[model samples]
Target: MNGGNFMSYVIGIDGGGTKTEAVLSDETGQVYARVLAGPSNLNSGSRESIEGTFLKIFSEIKNQQPELFQHIDYCFAGLSGTENHVNKEFIEALFKRLVGGQFPYLIEHDAVNALYSGTFGEPGIVQIAGTGSIGFGIDQHLNKKRVGGWGYLIGDEGSGYAIGRDALQVIFQHYDRNQKETILANLIGKYFEISGDLKDIVPTIYQAESPRNHISALSKVVFEAFDMGDTDAKSILQRAAKDLSKSIEMILEHFPLSNKQVVLVGGLFNRNDVILPMLEHFLNEECELILPKVEPVIGSVIAALQQINQKYIPLQK
Candidate 1:
């Protein structure tokens, strides 16, 4: 129970659509242990699916560093697709079970954590384009005004899901027009393992275990095709980037940060190198680009520190 060991035993978790990433760090932001587990997105999976990931992560950390069981001071879990109270409670209960009710657990939406990580608890616009898309604006008061963060069905306008859906639609339209030379048609055929006609893929996709996972996976194909100079794919990606920029503009128009920091995160930003430049070029007014060197889990840790210590802890790099 010494203070020295406790100083190095804080945990930060980023629960995303694809996976949950955790990092154990020192008080000075030096990472000591890192783990990646399955999706802890309570809204995306079953309760068992969510809790199982949390259990596996806790077990792995317990095995790796037993002292953390006693000395871990704080934990922050930021989950994707979190909007309602039900989603919040599900993550909270899972965290309680994971740490055996020890330490402080702060449950947050995924975009807020991106803000914390990207800006280091300062002010900025975090434009996230992953499986979904959202923009968060943080003011000096730490007040947050969010735009987007809706799922694939309604919102997620400039997200991977959006691009993927557009690509799929293109595939179907090409088929309807009997234009079979498009590469996306072949790509769609391979993706759904559908033979003969492209029409069957839609039905097959709906019947799959995780339809979002399938569509999200195809977004990578779209990005890759765009990289290889495919006109159709590039058009879809450009439109997606523009759509994302519009979301950012909406946030800026509403919240208007005097600091003018813009932090871009998520899979789409990582994959399509073109999109970031496109967004920056489109929104070239009073902005400082702050890329996140630390993982979003670090954002969760920053939030946890704020919760326990009531102040922002910038990474001393």
Candidate 2:
């Protein structure tokens, strides 16, 4: 795999709101070493945390495979909170600083990694519902589009933050219109260690910092409610699933996927048991829903290979 003096290995980085993963692979698409680090999503963690995470991952990789790290020729980084120009610029600069500017690299929204995770450089779609949500992909005509993922403060309908916020609204409704009892209040109260009187959750929410990780944390409780057979929890998750499906429909214009497959990647989909059936019900006959064969970081590795190899990565059968 030698190209000149160095080996033909490349690097792929997949950075999400919760954690970051990196992979080392050669031109033949063989993975060498994979490393994990803390959150690099600017939306989920601070800038310092992201810098630390990337540095840690790269350092770990270099330590594990010194020769391969020295020979890396290119890198592809798919990251969250980097869809914007400013954030993208910051990450690109940080990357050049860490890995040196001699190597070729491209920084892209994490959506590309998710999409490529399933499509293998072909045209397809990926619906990502994590701390935030976004439906993104290349359509049948090779048209690229991004549907949502505005952020929790404004939009992001199918996201954990949005779902958790809507679940809390159930309690808000109970206080607002004197609605019926539900298990969410009890479960959420216990999850937060707050009083059984859910109305008293005001101080806990309002007093928290921005981006509202606290609110997003309630999604775990929502899942708990659904397992307990709480009808209200089922309704909330169904609506969230429907919202995600609508995002897919919006991208495909209600058309079937050309590949007839859609990649589902994110922490939200980790609870595929509850969410998968609901998503399948909504996307019914639209596209086959699949979890990634390999994680998105491998997709990043595919992307890095594609940058030089150009559509040569064979679709895994």
Candidate 3:
């Protein structure tokens, strides 16, 4: 980590519930290669899938940019569900095999990357609403608090998966009650190519290898429907915003940050027009809600650079 050579570089990895993004950059902020792979969140899928995701990412870097891989002086990975000691240890061991332990390394929860993405390593709150959702905050004193990353079943209320699940719920409820037909059923049916056969949805959804991804992907359709003036779709998003705001409120109520900078990351916030206003409506007016232009992987790069040089700040472009 103390090496002071131009040849030395760093690898920054952002492992989210939906995908893993990695950046290979020099100490001077020169990016040699950028690689993307599947989800690597510890709670995302089975252990095998998570391992395969990292394997694919590391292998791609080593094969595509061998020189960059060899020159990696420090490695930093911001992974979801790593706040637990056991999950942290598991990922660290995996990194040793895939990334090699020769270089100094750090493993942190994905929220750190989100916070850094917006705050540049300063104290702030990050609400990660993707395939799953978690409310994470770092106070002025650097005290960290996390809430509502309980996966799809119990939490992740405002996530893409949750939105998709809500869509599914309304459509199926319409079918069950024999009520006035909703456009959501028609749209979702067409999306999945079920041809209006309600029975077909069960197997098509349940039988998939990754049902969560399939369901979460439906959130896109919900957003589309909202754009098309569908009341149900609009309602679903509104409800999600309420849940997301509640999660943020819980974090702020318990562990308040001096600066109410709430950085929005993940799929739901991507549609700031619909979701951002909803958040503003439910959340406090003073909360400086931010949608960062750069992705979270840039924050991971900052984390990696900080290992060797704290003053060296990488461009978040």
Segments in model 1 whose C-alpha atoms lie over 4 Å from true places: 1-9, 17-19, 32-39, 45-73, 93-102, 186-207, 284-286, 308-317
User: What pairs collide in candidate 1?
Assistant: none
Q: How would the candidate models be sorted by lDDT, starting from the highest?
A: 3, 2, 1
Report per-prediction Cα RMSD to one decimal: 4.0, 3.8, 3.8
Backbone clash total for model 1 is 0
Residues 1-317, candidate 3: write the lDDT tens digits: 44544445778899867789988876556678888888877766677888898888778877879866776778789987788787778888887887666577888988888877887667788888888898999887767888888888887889999999999999888888885357777788878987657668889899999999999999989988888888999999999999989988888898767788888988788798889888889886469888864568878877677667643455554
Candidate 2, TM-score vs. the true structure?
0.82
lDDT of 2 by residue, 197-304 (tens): 677777878887753678887888899999999888888899999999988888777444557667898789889998988988998456878788777887888778
The candidate maximizing lDDT is 3
Evaluate all candidate structures by whole-model CA lDDT and list the values in order: 0.76, 0.81, 0.82
Estimate the lDDT of model 3: 0.82
Error of 1 at 30 (Å): 2.4
Better of 1 and 3 by lDDT: 3
What TM-score, over all chains together, does every model reach?
A: 0.79, 0.82, 0.80
